[model samples]
Target: MKTTGKVWKYGDDVNTDVIFPGKYTYTIKDRAEMAKVALEDLDPEFTKSAKAGDIIVGGKNWGCGSSREQAVSCLKERGIGAIIAKGFARIYYRNCLNEGLPIIVSSEAVDAIEAGEEVTVDFDAGQIVTKKGTFPFPPYPEFVRGLIEDGGLIPHVKKSLGLS
Candidate 1:
């Protein structure tokens, strides 16, 4: 898969609470509603202005804290195409994949990508193309990429079983 989008850069240790505030974890069950409050605590404008296909760039340990699925779902609901970080909290990384949110870990790419810059990510090529230059990261495995392409684990499974 390939996507081109504007960058929404952030820092390290951006927890699940900040991504999708805990206060509404139980209250907001709908995906659309959850997206409306995404990044409310960390980047309020994001909830209002982030466009479809926008990419999030982050420093080390992005998505740290509780194992709230909302954190990943909200962004996916908001139409985030992908997230690139220096590193990711283990569970959050898995959550992203399970939710069909592609994530790339490339400290060099993270350091170079600037907020608001239009960048193109070629998942198949494992390249992030910026005006500055192109950076390469390990591409997802074919099976994993297929999982994302099919829209997460459940959808992929259902399709494999001829249920969808």
Candidate 2:
């Protein structure tokens, strides 16, 4: 159960630099420090102003740059509940899922929404409730969603799949 805050909107092709700036790569000794620098290009204050359940709306290629694990760590640390975008880079998407970052791909979600709206995500129902209306996303498998619920791929695999 994640609640939404003022929506933050972004354009298409938001790459890794937007997610994890190059200036912070060398400073990746800590996730809190790395999060302070997240989205340096879009919103330097994002990490500061972000609250739990805040949704990020962006266009295609929402994570098109490097495959740095810190990128996801930053957002998670900032209390970003989920990301809704038109699309995501293959590597970045996988990294997000592996890190238990809930990312949804939907053009309508990006194009038809504005900033500063409360949204409620019901994972079991697979729906997002905004002040405007309820928007449904494509179904996610129980297993995959379970993985995300377990707090990332590694933990999910360890618990669900019983692996080391």
Candidate 3:
């Protein structure tokens, strides 16, 4: 699979609290509503400016706080094409995969990419290309790609079972 988009850069240690904010959890049950406040604490204009297929690039330890699934859900709901981070909190990484959000671990790309620059990620080829340069990384395993392609674990499992 491949995706191309303008980048949205963020710093290290972006926690779940900033991603979804615990304050709204109780009041917001709808994914689209939750997405409106996504990264609002960090970048108040994100919801207004970000578009479908835009990528998020971040520094090391991205997603380092709580394991709130909304962090992943919010990004998905907002139509983030993928996230490229120097590193990821283990739980958040798994959560992204579980929610069918494409996330790549690429310190090189994270360090090199600038916010608003156009980028292309080739998942099948494991490469990220930009005006600056091209960076290569390992591609996701087939099973994981299958999960994402099928729109997360539940759908993947259901497909495996011929349920949907």
Give residue 37's lDDT in candidate 3 (0 to 100): 86
lDDT of 2: 0.79
Q: Tens-digit lDDT track for model 1 on 46-115?
A: 8889998999999999999999999999999999988999999999998988899999999888888889
Model 3 misplaced stretches (Cα beyond 4 Å)? none
TM-score of each: 0.94, 0.88, 0.94
Instruction: Write down the lDDT of every candidate, Cα atoms only.
Output: 0.92, 0.79, 0.89
Shift in Å, residue 43, candidate 2: 1.6
lDDT winner, 1 or 2: 1
What are the per-residue Cα lDDT tens digits for candidate 3 across 14-78? 88888889888788999998878889888887867888899999888888888889888988999
Candidate 3 shows a clash count of: 0
lDDT, candidate 2, at 128: 72
By lDDT, the best candidate is 1
